[model samples]
Target chain A: DVKVTQSLRYLVKRTGEKVFLECVQDMDHENMFWYRQDPGLGLRLIYFSYDVKMKEKGDIPEGYSVSREKKERFSLILESASTNQTSMYLCASRSGGSYGYTFGSGTRLTVV
Target chain B: SQQGEEDPQALSIQEGENATMNCSYKTSINNLQWYRQNSGRGLVHLILIRSNEREKHSGRLRVTLDTSKKSSSLLITASRAADTASYFCATWANSGYALNFGKGTSLLVTP
Candidate 1:
């Protein structure tokens, strides 16, 4: 089975702090995505990368950015975390030919 | 933007009963997928149905898609206590590499 590992399970940060959430996939998948899941808003994509050194903004990308320096690793960065940014962060990866996504355990971040 | 909207925010059913969830989307899609997420966990892919296909089944789960109405339904027969989880419907558009997901329907199966 493909394994996606998130670096953190829970995090608490002060407002205006810079935070990083890391995700690494064991399988050599070409696509990686970062999404923030809120209570009633479902999952909103923050960023996605199809290849190393490539990235694209998703629906709600204003407060987030991503880095994909390697094919196996994708990172979501919050330049200046705010109280409203508190949410469950999920990372998902899909192979080039497959439509199904394998997700990491997820990180719940709270900005105070 | 959220392309899929699943109805009945919550559902409760007895064990051995069947559970059905409905989803509606706004635009043309390449495929529709159903996912299950246990509390405090990430989503696990359940099934996928292409736009050209009308229905598909895996195990005790049956999925039907109506492209004309841009709607889909997922039926899980013979529910068990372990089947309790939140189910979400996601859509893959013709042009994008990412999927749009719905809020999800929380299903509870009581033993």
Candidate 2:
């Protein structure tokens, strides 16, 4: 089956430390996204890349950045981790508007 | 910001019972989708209903959309213990390509 793979399942980072969450998809989809899920906020988009080297900021893009060096790999970076940024990070990939997204297992990050 | 809001944050039902969830969105949308996530796992797509279409079904799942009211409902017939999971509703608005998801409804199906 096709899949989206996240590099880490759980992470702990100190405040002010830079954190990286990696995602890779085997479906060769054109669109990849990173979203952070909090208890009451649902899933808020951080950043998304529709093509290699192209990125767009989403609703909650503050303190976050993204890289799409290749078609299959998309990465989310936390420039300076803060305690408020602690949440479950999810990565999703979609080919087009006709289909639903396939998401990675998610990375739960705790910033202390 | 989330576009959709799902009612009844949690639900508990016995096996073989029907479970229904409702979602309401703010703006014009191209489509509304339902997703299921097992504990600590990724979401799996359950169904999608477009703005123009009122109803759609896949196996035991039935979804209905009412664009006039900007709402949608998902009905899962015959719940099983394995059906215990969190269900989220996501909407793709006409102005954007990304989907805005709701906080989700946690359902517990007890055998």
Query: How many clashes would you count in candidate 1?
Result: 0
Give TM-scores for every candidate, taking all chains together and pairing residue i with residue i: 0.98, 0.96
DockQ of each: 0.92, 0.87
Shift of residue B45 alpha carbon in model 2, Å: 0.8
TM-score of 1: 0.98
Q: What is candidate 1's lDDT per residue for A2-48, written digit by digit as tens? A: 79999799999999999999999999999999999999999999999
Give a tens-digit lDDT track for model 2, residues A1-112: 9999997999999999999999999998999999999887789898888889989988889999999999999999999999999999999999964569999999999999
Q: What is the C-alpha lDDT of each candidate?
A: 0.95, 0.91
Q: Write the per-residue lDDT of candidate 1 for residues B22-87, one digit (tens) a residue.
A: 999999888899999999999999999999999999999999999999999999999999999999
Clashing pairs in 1: none
The docking category that best describes candidate 2 is high
